[model samples]
Target: MQQPASTLATLWQIILRLIEKQGLDAEQFSRELGISAEVLRDPTARLPSRLTDRAFAKAEAVLADPAFALRAAECWHPSNLGIIGFAWLSSRTLHTGLKRMERFSRILGSRFSYRCAMEDRGLRFVYNHGRGDWDVGHAMTDFSLSILVDMCRTNIGHRLEPLEVTLRRPEPADTSPWRDYFGCKVRFGADEDSFLLDGETANAPLPTVNVPLANTFDAILTEQLATVFNDDIVSRCKAFLLRELTSGEPSAAALALALCMSQRSLQRRLAALGLTFQGILDETRHELARRYLDDSSKSVTEITFLLGFSEQSAFTRAFRRWSGMSPTGYRGNSAFAH
Candidate 1:
């Protein structure tokens, strides 16, 4: 996919703090950046990702520092990333935190889809920008990656160094800042951007783990992310479908009402998009099943109903047809494969 249209408002909050610390007024900064003060102040609001990118560029220009991102990214708190941060902090292990991140990262930013794939030796969290070129600039990428690494380190109470840090940006003349911060061989001019975590370190249980707290935050993040993407007809319908799965299969009328539209109009709109309600529901179930399988918290039997399947056998058969494996088998393989 290309970059998401918007990013979480919490990102702007972080940048607001950075700019304020530099003796700039928040309102002034918002005006100067052509961002709205109203939008910047709202916790649930999503700023245009391009606006935040502009802030990054403006910050660099104001500071006259090519490496301003390094300064702005320092000393992140758990609450800085909103619920996503809290969820990660309360996860049972680094692996669990990563699962929460893979699921809920859209709450923070969606420009890059985060994929957590396990290696025999370690875990790889990839920043996949997807096909076609979209420049996020080196500063934004560096700032985001640093916060991620810092968040992991804070959660585990360990200076958990990655096995490697790869970037697409060109090598700077002074590589010491990147090298010293990552505490690894930071590879510039790499094929893609990623962090490689040591398996033993990532899978180890953490003292900060709190399952109930983490689950609570995860649920909120899901609902919040849903509302964030609910502007469009397809997204609104899809969000309703995912929530509907928990109770049982939802009807077209119910989904239409949820979107405040009638069934006939809903069908007409969907048809215009070359989609059918059944097709959308099937796709939603398939995607939700794969996601639910990733979390060790939910059981196989529970996932069946969660996808609105009447029986475990039905779910298994459907899953086999979709993924060519049983739910259990798919769950097991997901840890070892992408």
Candidate 2:
């Protein structure tokens, strides 16, 4: 199932948290990721979906801690920390909500899986990525951890710091800040990625205002949250365009009919988002071309046909317009640079 774009909001939330923890310059981070700092600050900024993956990976490298991503996710808003997280908090007895989070997280995405268990004196939360783990980059992992932590904290009405934060990647120069914010021992090069919480701290009571209000908020938040993933028409349309671009056959009318919408309405909605079907098509083609050129052993002719180009010359012209170089030249330069 397609996850909501709000998942991206969760990513931005994680980025802000890192800023708070490390005091790293936002502009520098943006430059390192080849994005604009202004976009990072703007909650409504429309990011190219692929860039989210890239940014997270780069940020993880710079921060040197895998949990940095999760920390950022915890601080993201449009959250249900009060509702979804409150049930465990309001229980008369001690209970960990980590498993509950794993259950309901499908409203988020199925790209990753989570498992939680009660340990000897604490709780452990493990994150496992799905197939095409290529997409399971830094940003996604960080956002996942952040949301889980935030949910736990909000449920209990107190900041429940983790006992330990572990990462798959090696430590970065910013490792000290991670330790400071987590207020715990931080480990890198671990067997698996996870966060641990002390059992005593796990059962602590939180300061929530109204348990009843939490129930009401949960319903409201759940409905609003569903909208994030329920728009299948839009996702299908995007997918169709992506697949057809190799045939150079992306068409608004065809996509609209396939989506059971009028072309006019589709165009208007996309316009509101500062995108057009053509722009999406071109961007998809550009991204795919870059990836193929970089990774594949295919000839220029084969790639041109695969991208739906009528001829090599046409593909060359478009490639030059997109990247300011012929495909072969770009590939040569990339190989040389590497």
Candidate 3:
């Protein structure tokens, strides 16, 4: 299933707030992205992840700012993340709050994933594109880490600074914005994207820490997660596939492994739901192919790689079967339609 609409609203809340703060017209900006002005108001709405991606691109283009993520972080508030934000705020320490964020991160979106773990430096807070891997570009990686720092500053203390920051992307022409914002050593072209904090800083009690309240929110979040995943097997499968697709081509065996089920059982489960694994996989590819084609920055070859096609010709053939046109033709049509 697609990510909940409320998650997209959080992203828009940050982006639109930054736009307003910069003296830009939020409504006009929404129009530029071909979205409704009131899109963020409805909490139950679900939006295509590609729309969120386009909005980020739009903000970057309009503002001509490489520090767009930093600006958005400045405008971020706890409420922007809804229940997960509150659950985080009520945690006993920065480490607990981060753990809460990682647990309930699905409420944010399937497109983004996070990990909070211990590393050689200390407790490392790693944020990347895929949950199990790091394949996303710099724009999203920067925004995620920056806003996380914003969250830390808000809950722990404004003076809080991480031990070190590592990014997978190459260094930009100017690194001052990142260094100034992070207030630490920012390493680029690293093997992974992560933020390292000393053990003391991570485990230290927060000003707003409330164990009882945090427990209450945790219970509620647990219930919500159960309902979301148990409500539909198809949705759970779609979400899993979306995250795993970037690594390589999806297979029934791999999906079964990810879902912690035997191959036969997984197939039985899908058959019971009146669906097939290949059917779901094809649907996912169709949806993602169209979304990627809509992005002008993503060439057909890149989209092919992203969708896990071994060859561009294979992707084109698949696209032809799905859309009755070549990948390039579909992209041209998508551009005109938009």
lDDT, each prediction: 0.75, 0.59, 0.74
- The prediction achieving the highest lDDT against the true structure is 1
Order of models, best lDDT first = 1, 3, 2
Q: In candidate 2, where is summed lDDT lowest over 10 consecutive residues?
A: 87-96
Among these predicted structures, which one has the highest TM-score?
1
Q: Estimate each model's TM-score.
A: 0.73, 0.45, 0.64
Model 1: worst 10 consecutive residues (lDDT sum):
128-137
Q: What stretches of model 2 exceed 4 Å from their correct place? A: 1-49, 57-100, 129-159, 171-175, 220-338
User: Model 1 Cα displacement at 35 (Å)?
Assistant: 5.3
Q: After superposition, how far is residue 109 of candidate 2 from its true place, in Å?
A: 4.6
**Tens-digit per-residue lDDT, 1-338, candidate 1:** 23367787766777887677666686788888777767655767777777776786677667754555655557466666778877788876788888778876766776656788877769888775432223446776677678788878887797878999998878878888888888998999888788999987787767887766765675577577667766556666777776778888899999888888889999998998899998888877876776566567889999898889899999999889877899888877634222
* True-vs-predicted CA distance for residue 265, candidate 2, Å: 33
